[model samples]
Target: MSEEKSPFVVSASWLEDRLDDQNIRIVDAAWYLPAHNRNGRAEYEAGHIRGAVFFDQDEIADKTTGLPHSVPSPEAFAAAVGALGIAETDTIVVYDGPGLFSAPRVWWLFRIMGARKVFVLDGGLDGWKHEGRALVTVQTTPQPATFTPTYNGDAVTSFDAMRAIVDNGSVQIADARGPGRFLGTEAEPRPGMRSGHMPGALNLPAGSFASDGRLKTLAELKTLITEAGIDLDRPIVTSCGSGVTAATITLALHSLGHTDNTLYDGSWSEWGSRSDTPVTTEPTPKKDR
Candidate 1:
């Protein structure tokens, strides 16, 4: 069976055709972990899609918290996106260096902040360049626009709420880290953090949903979710190293027509770093819920 079409994603060709659309805003949302040894800003400055502005995940986050990529307040987010000349009403297209990696997080951020027409570029900049698409090294200066944000509190899971879920198993937890990290067999990329995952959290590495820097078909995603023991009928909270890749799981769920889900903003950056939260290495029994 063919995969269902996703309204939240657009093809490179689709975006290229609309590069000059007055109401469209293209964003380069590239981000990488320290272990990757790549700087998102440096890559964007070197060369990026023409007319695309860079979205600095670290700079636009809730810096008050020590956690990495923590969600910023509505006012802060509004100011940041507005300065990029992106209005909530514009048709926003976000792409990352690896196509399906960090782009989904920005897509989710816009949606939670009340942007109605945000979408991810199916083949990120990597794929675009490989296909001989156009790029420009010159920086883009956007005409500032006003953005009114309406924060969706329900879409965010608090540390306290996560603790309750871990204790009661009321919501299914999906960990987007690799199997080695999720199983505590590998050291965490972040120093001094615990290795294992949250108790009862199922491993669902973000890379599994995509191949060659592009997302897999919907049918394949459903199969992967079932194999990972995620219960689509139950509410889900997606998490990862620093709350970035977790959005890929959330995006997969949403694309599969699952709506009762949220992303843990603190993720392991907050959970594994602290001494109070519980961690486990054993695999969660499949379909126990």
Candidate 2:
């Protein structure tokens, strides 16, 4: 028998062939910025992969934190996924609309919560549709499945931890926001937030890791990180606007067997808004690039 692919990702046809596997559970983690005027839940209702449950990123977040998409309490995460009938043992497949966008956040969340078998849909929903695969408007209501979560606290970072990391230079900071946003050349999409980036952080825009709605191969991802001067062996703390796309970096790191990476759950929204945290507008030096 052929060796099974990495549980971290699977192709469209691979998932299609196993769509009916009773142990398989699919999640639609599609989300868009308000600027696009697109609603995730509404779009999912319009049409999505068959047997896919909608994992509402914005809705499932911890509202107590002022930061957008803050990591929820372990109890809250367990409750949320349990309500979705997602058992801890289920083989989960997560996907987003344009592909490598928001789905990696949900995928990272699952791994941090100790799900043994989870994967992101290669090429995402757009790729599946482009291949003329079937989509359904009908809702898939799964029976509630108990999900026992053991949160990996080390796999995530808080604002305080990020500050300390910056001060101590213990972990490599990988900012996943675009270069424009990283260099203060572009206005922040969110109001009331300062433009630019955290001190001592390097830009690694999440969009660069994929093309045409699919992530690049493993070799490409490794080269991307190395070319940016990031030493893959060092511990990394991934960050981006809010905290969603940061997970993309975490996912990429995980796919390469690097386990010392963590997501800064508050990301730029928290760092830029704080009066105490120092934000820099000077573009990164060419030597660092």
Candidate 3:
């Protein structure tokens, strides 16, 4: 297996050594499902990495859509990051409570918003705490910086585009939900939503790509993607329950040098809630691409 470290992921030790660096901005981008029964903000207030600021995934999102944590507008994103004292040039490192869950969403957000030096801390705050790293209850108050956003519109797959893709199989849909949920054999966590996968959508649960809060090696990732029947040479569109864990799939794909992928921002939250979209319980048969 290839042992190459991902440029988009940084070790906890690397972050600890540069915690005091002026240009390094650490973001506690922790978020949890209601089912997890943990408050992200309250946890941050209890203690966080020194100099780390909390990034509210729900608040920083596009509020007009009423979708949970939808992508925010470029202008809104700029203001949000700027207020958090992040600049376009800073080396932004994002981490969540469970390592690889929601942090990659923020990493994807920054990259799509034109922040080039963005990264996700390997083995999140939990791992950091396990290593006996010191945390502070005191919140960081940084001087606001100017962040000009150059949003990449192509990085986001819209509802209309997703519809077209589903109808025509123009792009392979890689879903990050669990096998039970994807196969319609389990109940959805959200009420009033239909159960099942999209027609021709491939199951690539986000949890399979990481272990112990760290993403697996490139060779392992490749093996998993292929095992899921995803063709790396073709275009891919990632989706999850609410578009959060989908970025984990995106991160894994990008780490393997696959660039032709877009995230379906609304994900199953929108697709399963609506009556217009087609839903299926039949799984796609595995075959060589």
Q: How well is each residue in 170-243 modelled by candidate 1, as lDDT tens digits?
A: 99999999999999999999898999999899999999988878788888888999889988888999999999
| Candidate 2 local lDDT, 1-289, one digit each (tens) | 1232234888999899998999999999988877668778887898998899999887788998877877888888989999998988999999988889999999989888879799999899889989999999999998898999988998889889999988887888899999988989998889888889987788889999887877777788888888887888889899999889998888888878899888899998999887888889776553443
Overall lDDT per candidate, in order of appearance: 0.92, 0.86, 0.93
Tell me how far the alpha carbon of residue 12 in candidate 2 is from the true structure, in angstroms, after superposition: 0.8
Q: Where is model 1 more than 4 Å wrong at Cα?
A: none
- Lowest summed-lDDT stretch of 10 residues in model 3? 280-289
| Model 3 / residue 56 / CA error / Å | 0.5
Question: What pairs collide in candidate 3?
Answer: none
Query: How does model 3 fare in lDDT?
Result: 0.93
Total backbone collisions, model 3: 0
Encode model 3's per-residue lDDT on 28-134: one tens digit a residue.
99999888898889999999999999999999999899789999999999999999999999999999998999999999999999899999999999999999999
Q: Please estimate how well model 1 matches the true structure, expressed as its whole-model Cα lDDT.
A: 0.92
Which lDDT value does model 1 have at 77? 96
